[model samples]
Target: MAYCKYHPLTASTYHCESCQINQCDHCVDDDPEHPEPRCFVCAGAVDSLGATDIAPFWRRLDRAFHYPMNKQTMMLIFIASLLASLGAFIGGITGFCLSLIVTAITTKYSFLCLQRTTDGGVTAPDMNEAFSGGFKIILHIIFILIGISLMIVGVERLFGGLASVLFSIFWMVCLPAVFINYARFEQIGPAINPIEIGRLVFTLGGAYLLLLLFIAIMIASVGTLHQILEEQVYFFSAILQSIVSYYYLIVIFHLMGYLIFQKQKILGFTSRLESSEHSAGRSSQNRMLANIDVLTKEGQFDGACATFKQGLQAFPTSYELHSRFFDFLYGLNKLDEIDAFWPTYLDLVGRQGRENQASTAYQRLLLLDKHYQPTSPDVRYRIAQACFEAGKSVLVVKLLNGLHRDDPQYKALIPAYELMAKALDDLPNKREQAEKLRRMMRQLAHHST
Candidate 1:
C-alpha cells in the first residue's frame, strides 16, 4: 500500500510512476502504455517545455525588425533606430546630441512619408541611396572644415585680422545657404518640392532661434529683478514663472497650428498631383469615383450610413462626417441613435457656435410627429405631455410656452397648445389664457389649411 500525495480518498495502494504518486487507480489517472509515471512535479516541468521550444532568438528578431505590419515604413524606422542606437552607444554626450539630430531628421521623414501616404502616392524612399547621400554629406563637411582651417591660418595671416573677420562672416552666411540647397536636393524629387525642403529647414531653425531668445529673455528678467525686489521676490518669481510657462504654451499652440495648416496644404497639393495622374486614366477613375459616389450617395441612405461609420473609424477627428451621419440617421427616424453619436458630435463642434448640429438633431428628435406619445415625439416632449396628461396643466403650459417662444415651428408644440387649451378649459385661474390659445390654434389651423 502506497499513499496518494494529493488526497486520501481510499486506502488502496498502486505504484503510479507517471505522476510518481503511490496511489490506487481511483487516486491517479495515469496513461498505462507509456506509464513511466511522471510525478506532479515532473508533469509541471514538462508543461514548461512548450515555452522553451520557441523559435530562435535571431528568427524572432528578424520577424520583429523586418516583417513589421507596416513593412516599408517600419524598415525606415528600423534603419533610423539602428543609426540612433549606434550613435548613442558611442558616448553619453555624443549619444544625446546624435539622438536629437536623428530624432529631428526621422520626425521630418515620417511627416513627409505620412503626407505622401495620405495623398495616395508611393512613399517608399531608397534607404541605401539615402545612407550613401548621408556619407557624402559627412565627407563634404570634413573637407569644408579642413579648407576653412587652412584658409583661416594661411590666407588670413597674409591678409590681416579685419580681412579674416570679413571672410569668416561671408563664409558663415554662404555655408548656411549651401547646406540649405543640399538639404533641398536630399528631399526634392518627383513626389516632393525644393520649396517644401527649404520651408522645413526655415521652420525648424526659426523655431529653435525663437525658443532660445525666449529663454534668454526669461533668464535676463528673473536675474535683473531678483535683487531689486528682494522681499517680494518670491511672489514676483512665481508670477514671472507663470508668464514664462504661458508664453511657452502659446508658442507650442502656434507651432501646432502652423504644422497642421501647413501639412494640410502640402498634402492637398500631393493629393491633387495623384488626382491628375488618376484623371489621365479617365474611364477607370470615373468608374472608381462613381463607385465612391454610390457608397456615399444620399439615396443609398443605408450605404451612406455605413460609409460614414467606416469613415469615423478611419478619421475619428472628422466632424464633417459625424454631422452628415447624424443627418442621415435623423432622416431614417433613428432618434435613439442620436445619443450614441451626440457626444462625439458636440466635441467636434466645440463650445461656441450658432448652428450646433447635435443640438439641432436633439431638438428635431423631440419634435418628431407632433403627437408627444411613445411613438410620437422624443422623451423631453413626452415628459411635457405626461405632465399635461397627469393634470399638471400649469407645468405643461409653462414648458410649452417656453418651447413656442424659443422654436415656434416645434411640431410637438402644436399638440402642446391643444393640450394646454383642454387642460385649462374650465380652470378658474386660467380660463382667459386658455381661450386665447384656442383662438390662436383656430387661426393656425385655418392658415395651415
Candidate 2:
C-alpha cells in the first residue's frame, strides 16, 4: 500500500511514477522503469542504482540548519547559545568585546533584511552592502568603547567619592543605551533613545526611593510604638509587611495588563485604518460614477464626457459604461466630445494619439468624397509634421504633395516643403527620388510666382 506523495484526499496508485498516487504528470522527474522515482520532498530514490552523489558542504550545512524551514529558528537559537558560551569561556572582558562585534554584524545584516521585508518582500541584500553596513556598526562600537573607557579612567583618577557615585549612575544609564544602540544598528530590536533611558532611570529610581522612604517610616513608627506597647507593635509590623507585599504585586499586575492591552489596541487601530482606506477608495469610485450619470442626464454632453473620463481614470475597466455614454455624445455631433474622447480612445487601441488620430480622421474625410478635404491648413501641416517626426521621409513626401495640390494658396507650407526635400536627400537608398522631389518643389515654386 503506497501512500500519496501530494494530497491525502485521494487514495489511488499506479505502477509508473508519472501516474503515482496523489502526484500529477508534471511532478514526475523521470520514467520509473529508466532508473527510479526521485522524491523531491526528501531527495531520495525509490529504485536505487550505485551512483556516487556530490553535493556542496554549504548545502549539507543548510539542510542541517533547515535554512528556510521552521528549524531555521531553532538553528538561530543554537547559534546564539554557542556564541554566548564561547563569549563566556573567553572571560567577561574578551567575551563582551568579541560579542559586541559579532552582535553588531549579525544585527546589521538582519536589520537590512527586515527593512527590505517591510517595504515589500524578504529581499536579499547584496553581500557588499551587508558587509559595508556591518563594518560601519563595528566602527561605531569601537568609538563607543573608546568614549566609555576615557570616561571611566577620568572619573577614577580625578574625581573621588562624588565621581564614583556619578559613575555608578552613568553606568546604569549607559548599559541600556549601549544595548539599544547595538540592537538598532545590528537590527536586533527597536531603536534606542537616550531620552527613553533617562525616563526609565528616573522612573525606577523614584519608585525605589519611595519604597525606601516607606520602609524607613514603618521602622521608625514601629520603634516608637515598641517602647509604649511592645506586644501590639509586633502585630502592627507584621500587618505593615503583608500590606506592602500585596501593594507591590498589584502594581506589577497592573503594569503587565497595560502593556498587553495597549499593544492589542494599537494593532487593532492599524487594521481599521487600512480597511478605512480601502472603503474610501471604493467610495470615491462610486461618487465619480454618480457624477457621470448626473451630467449626462442634464444634457451637458461635454461636461458629462469629461466627468465620464475622470470616472474611467478612477476605474479603468468602466470602459463598457464609458463606451455606451460616448456613443450618445457622438450622436449630438459635439466637436468637444471628439477632442475629449479621441486621445483616450486612440490610447485604448494602442495607437499614438497626435499622428494616428489625425491620419485616421484625414483618411475618413478623403473617403467621404474624392474632393472633400480638411478645412484647416494647420491640421494638414501637422500631418506632414508627424511624418517627418516619425522618420518616414517617403510618407512626408506624399503628405506634402497632397497638401500642395489641395491648398496651393497656403504660403505657410513652402518652408515645410523645403525641409522635407532635405530630409528625403538624407534617406538611405533614395538620393535619385529626393532629387526628383526637389525639382518638383522648384516647379511648384515657379508656378506660385
On TM-score, the candidate that comes out on top is 2
* Model 2 pairs whose backbones collide: 107-186, 108-186
Summarize candidate 2's per-residue lDDT along 1-449 as a digit string, tens digits.
Answer: 23334433432121233323333212223333335444332334433211112122223333322322334333333444455446655767888976665455454544443333222222233433444466676666566666666666677788876886787677554453344334324532222344544543454444334433434454565566545554655544443433333223222222222222222222221111111122224344454444444345446566766766667676665545445554655556454554455445534433424454445553443444444333455544665566566665655565566566677678776777776776678678768877887787788788878
After TM-score superposition, the amount by which residue 335's alpha carbon in candidate 2 deviates from its true location, in angstroms, is 20
**Candidate 2 wrongly placed segments (more than 4 Å):** 1-104, 109-136, 178-307, 310-449
Candidate 2 has a TM-score of 0.26
Candidate 1 residue pairs in backbone clash? 17-37, 18-37, 18-38, 19-38, 19-39
Off by over 4 Å in 1: 1-140, 147-170, 179-300, 307-327, 331-449
